[model samples]
Target: MRRIAPDHDQLLAIVAEVFREHGYEGASLALIGEATGLGKGSLYHFFPGGKEEMARAVIAHIDGWFEDNVFAPLRDGADPSAGIEQMLAVTDSYFRSGRRVCLIGAFALDDSRNLFAGQISNYFGRWITHLADALVRGRHRPAEAMELAEETVAAIQGALTLARAADDAGVFSRMLRRLRMRLGLPAKT
Candidate 1:
C-alpha cells in the first residue's frame, strides 16, 4: 500500500480541525503534524512561516467559507427573510449543531488573539454587518437591524460556548429557535 500526500486544501481542512479542537495556543506543531501525518519539514514546506502562518491560512479558509456560504447570501439573496433563514441553517450545520467549536471564537478568547486580531475582527465584523444588511432588507430600521445583528451573533457565540460547557447540544438548538422567533421567522417543524 502507498501513502498519498494531502493537497493544500486537504491539509488546511485537517489543520483547521486540530485548531478547532485544541485552539490556536494549544495546537502545537507536533499536534498538527500528528493530525496531518506530515513531518515538521513537510509542514514547514507548506507553511514556511510556521504555526502562525498555518493559523492565518486556516482563518482565511474559514473566512472564505463564510464569505461564500453565509455572508454573501445575507447580502445578495433575493428574499431577505429567506437569506436570514439560510444563514441560520448554514451556521447550525457549520458549527455541527454546537457539537463543534468555532475556531475563530476560540482564538478570540485565547492569547493568540493578539496575533490575529485583525483577521478575527474582520470575520466577526463582516458577519454582523452582513446580517444587519439582511435585516434592513427585511424591513428593520437601520439601528434596530444593527442591534439585532449584534444580538444574534452574540447569542450564537454564547450558545456555542454554553453548549460545549454543558455538554448539551440542545442548548444551541434552543437558542437557534429563540433567534428565529426574535427574527420573526417561522419555527422549524
Candidate 2:
C-alpha cells in the first residue's frame, strides 16, 4: 500500500498533539516520527531545524488558529455580547470541552517555556487584552473590564487544570456555565 503524506496543516496538527501529550521537552523526535510516520531523515527534511523548529511551527499554527477563531471574534465583532458568546463557544470547542490539553499552557509550565517565552506570553496577553476590550464595549467600566477579563482567563485556565486532574469533563462544563452567568448570558443547552 502506498502512503499519503500529510499536508502542512495536517502535519502541524499531528505535531501539536505530540507536544500536547508529551510536552516540548518530552516529545522526542522518535515519538514525533512514530506519530507522523516520518523517518528521521524525512522529519529533518520537513523541519530543517529539528525538534525545536517543529515545536515552533506547532505553536505558530495554534496561534494562527486562535487569532482567526477566538481573538478576531472577540476583537472585531460589532456586538460585544455576541463576541463574548462566540469566544466562549469557540474556546469550548477548541478545548474539546476539557478533553484536550492546552499545549501552550502546558509549555508555560515546563522548562521549555524559557525557550518560547515571547510566543507563549503573547498568546495569553492578546487573549486577555481582546477579552477586556470586548467587555468594555459591552458597557463595563474600563478597570472592571480589565479585571473581569483577567479573572475570566484565570478561571478558565484553572478549570481546565481541574477538569484534567479530576478526569471529569463536567468540571469544565460547570465552570463555563458560571462564566456565562457572570457575563449575563444564557446557559448553553
Candidate 3:
C-alpha cells in the first residue's frame, strides 16, 4: 500500500493560525505540535531551522495572498472606485474569517528580540509601499496617497483590534466605509 503523506500546506495553515492567535513568543513548540499533530521531532524533520523558518514561511504565504488578491486587481487598470471596492471586498473577507492579527504584525511582535527583526521591518515597509503605490495609481497625489495609505492601513489594523476585542465586526466595517468615503468613493448604500 502506498503511504499517505501529511499535507505540509495544511500543517502550515494550522501553524499560521496558532501563531496569529498566540504571539510568536507565546506559540511554543508544544502548542504547535498539538495544533498540527506533529511531534517535536516531526516538526524539526519538516523545518530544520525551526521557528524562524516557520515564521518566514507564514510571512511569505500572506505576502503572496495579499499581492494576488489585493494588489493585482487594483493594478488591473480599474477606476478608483472599482479598485477601492475590490480592496474592501478582500478586507471584508479577511476580517470575516476572524484572522484579525496580521501575519506580519504577529511575526514582528514575536520576533522583536530576534535577528529576523530587520527582515520583518522591511516586510511591512514594503507592504505599505505597495499600498501607497496603489493609492497613487488610483489618482491620489503622491504625498496624499502615501499619507492616506498609511492611515487606511493603520485604521484597518486598529479596527481589527477593536472588532476582536468588542466581538463585533461593525468596528472594522465602519472604518472601511469611512475610508471609502474619504477617498471620494460613494459609500455603500
Candidate 4:
C-alpha cells in the first residue's frame, strides 16, 4: 500500500484512543496500525522507538491538550466558580471526545516503572500545580488550595473511571457537581 504524510496530531489522537482502550500493556502495534490506518512499517517510521515512543508522543500531545483545554483558562484570573466550570467542561469534552481513559492514570497503573515515567510525573505535577495555583488565587489558603486541588483532581479521575465503566455521562456530571460543592465552589450563574 502506498504511504501518505502522517498527520502526527491525528495519529496521536487515534493513538490516544488506543491507549485509552487497551492501556499501556494491551495496546499492540497491530492495534495501533488499525487505529491509525498506518501499516506496521509506516507506524514504525513515525514512531521508531515502538510503543515507548508512541506513548511519549501521546504524553506530549496530552500535555499540550492540558495547556490549551485546562490550565490556560485558569491563568486568565477566572474566578473559583468559572474555574470549576472550565474544569467540568473540559471533563465533559474529554469523555465526549471518546478518549475517555486518562493517559496519566494509565501510566500510573502501568508496570513499566521507568518507561514513560518522568513524562507522566511531569504531567501530573504540572496539572496539580495548575489547580493549586488557581485555587490559591481564588482565596483559598496555600495549603488548603493544594489540598482542594488534589482532592478535586482525584475526584475527577475517579469519576472518569466510573463513567467509563458504566458508560454513563450523568454519573460523571453528578460526581463533578458533588465535588464542586465539597470544594466550596458555588454554581456559576
Ranking by TM-score: 1, 2, 4, 3
At residue 20, what lDDT does model 2 achieve? 88
Candidate 1 vs candidate 4: the TM-score winner is 1
Candidate 1 deviant stretches above 4 angstroms = none
* Candidate No. with top TM-score: 1
Worst 10 residues of 4 by lDDT: 91-100
Structure candidate 4, residue pairs in collision: none
TM-score of 2: 0.96
lDDT of 4 by residue, 118-165 (tens): 887887777778888888887889999888888888887788778778
lDDT measured at residue 153 in model 1 versus the true structure, 0 to 100: 98
Per-model TM-score on C-alpha atoms: 0.97, 0.96, 0.85, 0.87
Tens digit of per-residue lDDT, candidate 2, span 24-140 = 888999999899888898899999999989988888899999999989999999998898998889889999998888888888999998888999999999999999999999999
Using alpha carbons, what is the TM-score of model 4? Answer: 0.87
lDDT of residue 3 for candidate 3: 33
Q: Local distance difference test, per candidate?
A: 0.95, 0.90, 0.74, 0.79
**Model 1 poorest ten-residue lDDT run:** 1-10
Candidate with better lDDT, 1 vs 2:
1
Candidate 2 off by > 4 Å? none
lDDT score for candidate 2 against the true structure: 0.90
lDDT of 1 by residue, 101-151 (tens): 989999999999999999999999999999999999999999999999999
